[model samples]
Target: MMGLLLSLLSGLIFGAGLAISGMADPARVQAFLDIFGAWDPTLAFVMGGALIPMAIAWKLRKGMKKPLAAGAFDLPGTRQIDKKLALGALFFGVGWGISGLCPGPALADLAIAPGPAAIFIGAMLGGMALHKITVE
Candidate 1:
């Protein structure tokens, strides 16, 4: 129950941040992503804004015994830059560049345009399914 509440609050805050930053609009996100033609550095600042809190949380987590509930520092162990990592990043970048919608931003934008959101989400899920089947 507590975790569910926290999750909802977190999502609300995330959506609020996206809306406030104008990232919920695909055009704004696209403009921010467009570095070659008409570049916008708004996203850099937004990213930096998010990073500050994340850095603080990372430092705080290091000192804590465990999280508020369960799980003890469940961080990724692999630091190796392998083909899988590179390929995943490449695909993610291509998707973001073409659609101006990363996972978080895409979810946030769903409130405005359900059609594209539904299609994009379906494609995303399909990719996940394909990856799972192929990886196995």
Candidate 2:
């Protein structure tokens, strides 16, 4: 129950941050990606701002025995850059470039613009399902 509550709280905070930072807007995100055209660097500041807390968390994780709401810190155990990693990154980059929205922003946009967000979320879920069926 505690973990569930913590998860919800964390999600809410993340979603709120996305909304507040204007990350939830596809046009703004697309502008940020448009370096060759009408580029926007505002999102860069937002990304940089996020690194502060994450850097602190990474440092703190070095000394942690367990998470506050979980039995263990389920960190990624791999450091190798394999074919799978490269292919996945390529796909992610292509998708982000085309759609101007990734999973986090897409999910956050659900409340602001349900139509487009729903379409993107549905396609994302379908892709995940396809990956599970074929890969795992």
Cα lDDT computed for each candidate against the true fold: 0.83, 0.91
Q: What TM-score does prediction 2 earn?
A: 0.95
lDDT digits (tens) for residues 27-103 of candidate 1: 77788777787877888888888899999999998899998855666778989999999999999989887887777
**For candidate 2, lDDT tens digit of each residue in 1-136?**
9999989998989999899878889999889999999999998998898899999999999899998899998977999999989999999888888888899999899989999999999999999999999998
How many residue pairs clash per model? 0, 0
- TM values, all candidates: 0.90, 0.95
Task: Please state the error at residue 47 of candidate 2 in Å.
Answer: 0.9
Candidate 1 ranges with C-alpha deviation above 4 Å? none
lDDT of 1: 0.83
Winning model by TM-score: 2
List the lowest-lDDT window of 10 residues for candidate 1. Answer: 67-76
Clashes of 1: 0
Instruction: List where candidate 2 sits over 4 angstroms from the true fold.
Output: none
